[model samples]
Target: MSENNNPPEEKKRPEGITNSYRERLKALKQARQYSVAGDIPKAVERYSTYLYALASYFGVTEDKLSPSFFDTEKEISELLLISHAYWDLSKAYDRSPNLHKESIRCLDQFVKFTNGFKYQHINAQMLKKFIKRKQAHNMKAFQNAYTKIQVDSKGCFIASYSYGPEHTVTNDLRKFKQAIVNYRLGFRFVEVYYNTSPAIINFLEKSGIFGCLLNKVFIRPTLLLISKSARHL
Candidate 1:
């Protein structure tokens, strides 16, 4: 009998990388369900856990991981720009004692990334301002300050504040801060429009459309409110 000369077949090893996005997405979906079900703590846990796994897969710290990790081009896309979906998980941490630090950490990483692009500059600045606002003021009070000014699309200004019977000096300060936030919101809106569509804004401005927008009668009263609030602050 002739000896067999064929070499034994070598079994192939599995690829080192697995796309875990499906699993991450499943976790996110579960989180949303839990959130809708009013199980907020579980939802936060699920989202934070998924974020940790995703960051580990990318070999980045959780705070540094970005949506670009999931992008084929590994660069900016409309998903990252228009959606801001990454902040969802981070904001979830806001309600948890242990997770709130992680929330700020993640926001810090995003703020750092924004420095690389001019379009994100205002967002980065605003994020930093938000962080400062969180640190310098009580969170509940800060939130109160955020809710005072309501500007409708029709250019109407609806302002509400509680000076209260005590009227302590701190109340005045709080009112001032709220006024500043309201003032910044207007500037921020314009910045967002310019950042989102610079070419269109430029065309509009050159055609005098932007001037017409700025000329709205309601704007004068809004500025006056800001002026009064600044003085009080």
Candidate 2:
């Protein structure tokens, strides 16, 4: 197992998922055409090639595979499509657990990825909603520890806890702090309230800035929705 230092950048996730299915569909159709033409060997070869592609797509050795092994979104989608193809293959070959396992893998991906917000694709507004929820808890902790709160000149609400013990601060708080820095990059005033829950912590840990401080710091008390009218100002 050699690691690739630079993997190919994917097309946007939705497009990539669609294209994978389209390609496999074409391959299956071609195999069907060969079968109808009475070329059994060629049909089998085409299917074998398709199966190889599916295995490669999921990064698994065909003989030793499991539903648990397929984790990434792309891998799961690939497995789902391949499982459908396997059903098609059963018409030509003997049905076995080996062939049916792809369906199981698809269900595994669905269960694992669908149960949490982190796996779900969300928009900017939804993301902000999650941030606001997390910071609510952080704000409570902040208020309890350091009572100092004031507005800075740039319109940022600063909850200064410079003297507060570090132990009181959690990873979610650090992430909320980083998010505020990013949110206030252009605007002068952003409100920050503190508190947290699972949604924000998951976002923060994946954000690559969990423990890392921003060049500037703050957290938002509410989700900011700048409309067209506000943009002009």
Candidate 3:
């Protein structure tokens, strides 16, 4: 008298994900060796080559395949190589002509799921940093919000706006402790400050202040790019 029944669930995600990361670590080490052995091209090539292969544990990629999991989202969230592995796979998708847009989509999903806030919490250091960034935001926004809007001889309404903050402390040690976390995990933070988007890009270009921004950034273990507007003297 047997019935169709499944066995009780068991924990599985951590071990596989850990093992996969370890294997990738080994591959990266080999890539370095190749570089040291004077095979720079192969070394660079090996760095992110097998990223998609590591996605088996998650229900990612073309296949909806996932390892037997007690809890899916939490397990993926626990992956230690969350930064590098996902970045590599995202690039893999991007370089593939068939998967270019898909790659961005995949990366967007990964970014949403594992932002710095999830990886790092509001510890004492971060709280102080948050306060500082908020202060900078307020000062700059007020400065811009109050500037007079002028018009030239032409029908054009003469005005200017900025990416704001107009400056980031770069590693700011305090303000970007979260960004440092991501850097320590081996991914670079490459967004413009105060919100850099296509619209912002167009605005900056139209305002003709994009060049000065190149000088204000602090690039280091992490990078910070900020911009603000000032009427020409």
Question: What are the RMSD figures for all models against the true structure?
Answer: 16.6, 19.0, 20.1
Best by TM-score: 1
Compared with the true structure, what per-residue lDDT tens digits does model 2 show for residues 151-206?
Answer: 11111112222212232222233334444444544222222232222344445446
lDDT of model 3, residue 86:
40
lDDT of 3 by residue, 154-226 (tens): 1110011222222233213223333232452311222222123334445545655443453234221123222
Q: Return the TM-score for candidate 1, rounded to 2 decimals.
A: 0.40
Give the runs in model 3 whose Cα sits over 4 Å from its true position.
1-22, 28-80, 116-233
Off by over 4 Å in 2: 1-26, 35-38, 57-59, 69-77, 95-233
Ranking by lDDT: 1, 2, 3
The Cα RMSD in angstroms, rounded to one decimal, for candidate 1 relative to the true structure is: 16.6
TM-score of 3: 0.27
lDDT of every predicted structure (CA atoms): 0.45, 0.37, 0.35
In candidate 1, what are the lDDT values of residues 78-113, reduced to their tens digit? 223312334444556665676666655544444434
Q: Is candidate 1 or candidate 3 better by lDDT?
A: 1
Q: Ten-residue segment with the worst summed lDDT in candidate 3?
A: 149-158
Q: What residue runs in model 1 are displaced by over 4 Å at the alpha carbon?
A: 1-19, 67-86, 97-99, 109-233
